[model samples]
Target chain A: MKTNGIELEKEILDQLPAIVLAVDKNFNTLYANNAALTFMGSTPENVIGKHCYNMVRNPQCKTPECCIAQAMADGKVHSIRSEADGGTGNRFLESTAVPLKDEKGEIVGGLEFVLDITQKVLDEKKLNEQGRTIRDMSTPTIKLWDGILVLPVVGVIDTNRAQHMMDSMLNKILSSNSRAIIMDIQGVAAVDTAVANHLIKITKATKLMGCECLISGISPGVAKTLTQLGINLGSIKTKATLSDALEEAFSMINLRVITTEAKQ
Target chain B: MEADSFRLLNGVKAMMDSGDEYSVSGSVTNRCYIACINGELSSAQMGQLYDEIVRMAEKRELRGVIMDLNGLAVLDSAAFCVLRKISGALALMGLKSAWMGIKPAIASSLVDFGADVDDLCICQNIEDGVRLMSFQK
Candidate 1:
């Protein structure tokens, strides 16, 4: 069927999941689709001729910055993310407005279609929080002894991750007043020249704080790779294993770890 | 000398020739000479502070010198270079130098700027610096 001589498939518009509405230049609601009427919790008779802002209160509502106003002014389609208040409570909506013209191509009203993005927005927020938690957990610093701290690094080392590791290690050393730090990289997938350089930087920074840094858990492959790369860790100590590093740390702090005999 | 000692113990404010405000206050606590540095660190200020510290070290038996940088927010490369020179000079004079209260950001920046701080002893606070000095002795 057609509305006002405009070919509009009313059946398709009514079946659409998105909320569609037509509003005049003054922001008065002219036509509300089935989804729009349902979202407003009102019938077409009560919704029509009502002010759009009075029904859906959003940040851009009642402002010249509204998507519909922008589309009407520019005679182009505009889209915006709006937190709209509807029958289902406050929801995130991606609203797109297209300028509606007559036979003369003069702007008369605008058609706005809004997609509820509340779930998508919630998912994105949850994902961001999880990423932060993972970033923090990836660099865990633990105090192994009175004056020694150990950091277990697990994963691919990027520039950002390396910087984060450095920050975490430095802060831990400051708080713990530890004289030595052992970075165990057994879980590291691989190490390149860049990663080696970052490690050197960490050592230098820690030394400036009066903390000796020792790198441990160097696999045979990593050791060969370092030699091939000709990356000198300089004066920073390196150990083949965490056990050896721990022993060296204990010696630095004048601590001796001895195993006791089993009791009968 | 007595007035100097009193000033050193009570903390003295040294105004540079350029009218910049800085201080190098020294006090003997736990037998460790603690020098509290404040205001923006400059080479000239460090030079004056070094001369005063060396003169004082000549008269007194010092376990070590703890340079407290708690009042500082940013330590530039020039200041760090001056600090390295001071650390070396202090060592030659038989006085160990331990930097105390270095902020984490400053430490990170120092390394990022490629400052050679390996020869210098750094401590978390005055207590740790004093302990480190005693341990070294």
Candidate 2:
């Protein structure tokens, strides 16, 4: 009955989808299930007595920082995610190592559990790249004409995005040597008295940098809120549309665009 | 160090005389008092809060008052108006008032709601507040 039970346990281990194996205290391969053997590219007969680390296909096997070695040293379970040369190709995997104990409850070896996490790692990296792309695309500083920079505002302006806009605007102004900047707020949903004040501060700062800042597209609702809040934004120039602001920007720089459609 | 601290999470309890009484943090005859507000303070609580600060300021040679809003989460327009009112009262009492730990959201909203921060001296934290209020400015 005990013999049959041992065979049953062995059969269950062999059928497990995860690559599982056990190594003795000396790091010798004591047991390598079918999946482990497949990972090693060798039969149990050829792998069982070999050094556990050397038998594994992972390049980190020779290093003392291996999860199994750490588990054996501490006589506890340890896990680490690493890229390794697997049975197929290089793959990222979470290698979990649990200390194997003798009958007396002393750790004599360790059982290693490996689960491929290549796709998960790749997906996380892709997500981070997408986030960077979104942030970059969201804030676009445009130079409409020489000495004129236009920042078309849209969507909600969180504190982080507001700070980012400030930084980007200052840098763009310095780099372009522009004399005027038209901040179009047509697409923005709402504005508070504080935002208007912050906008005034930005224009004041731009003025210090020798540039005129024009705030265009002041919606009636925002205008009403500002007045009700008792915030005075009368000091800053304003316009209803981007084109009107551009025309004002042109007049400030002593340049006028006389558009006459050529007869074709 | 008298080590007296009071917390009123709800507004109704603050109105009834027994709950809001507390001592200042420093010397036995300390002139400056610290009120560390925790949790949500609704608009209804502002009247009680103002009365408490006035009561605390009465006849104690009050040099300064430190208001710490580190734990406050939500702030409405009424609350902001009450804050402005309380600051004005403190100024009238010849007390130097310092506000500490104004969360980013509250700071933004205060500005958005046309609440002027210039009414009170704003500090970064309790330590900064203590230092600022300690000096005779």
Q: Which candidate leads the pack in TM-score?
A: 1
Task: Give the TM-score of each candidate.
Answer: 0.72, 0.47
Candidate achieving the largest lDDT: 1
Candidate 2, residue A111: lDDT: 91
Candidate 1: misplaced stretches above 4 Å? A1-17, A21-79, A85-89, A97-112, A258-264, B1-20, B38-63, B71-94, B131-137
Instruction: Show pairs that collide, candidate 2.
Output: A194-B111, A194-B112
Worst 10 residues of 2 chain A by lDDT: A201-210
Q: Model 2, A183-232: lDDT tens per residue?
A: 98877788876576678666655553446789999889888888888888
Reference-based lDDT, residue A215, model 1: 94
Model 2 Cα displacement at A189 (Å)? 5.3
User: RMSD per prediction, one decimal?
Assistant: 7.8, 15.6
- Residue A46 in candidate 2 has what lDDT? 94
For each candidate, the alpha-carbon lDDT, in order, equals 0.85, 0.74
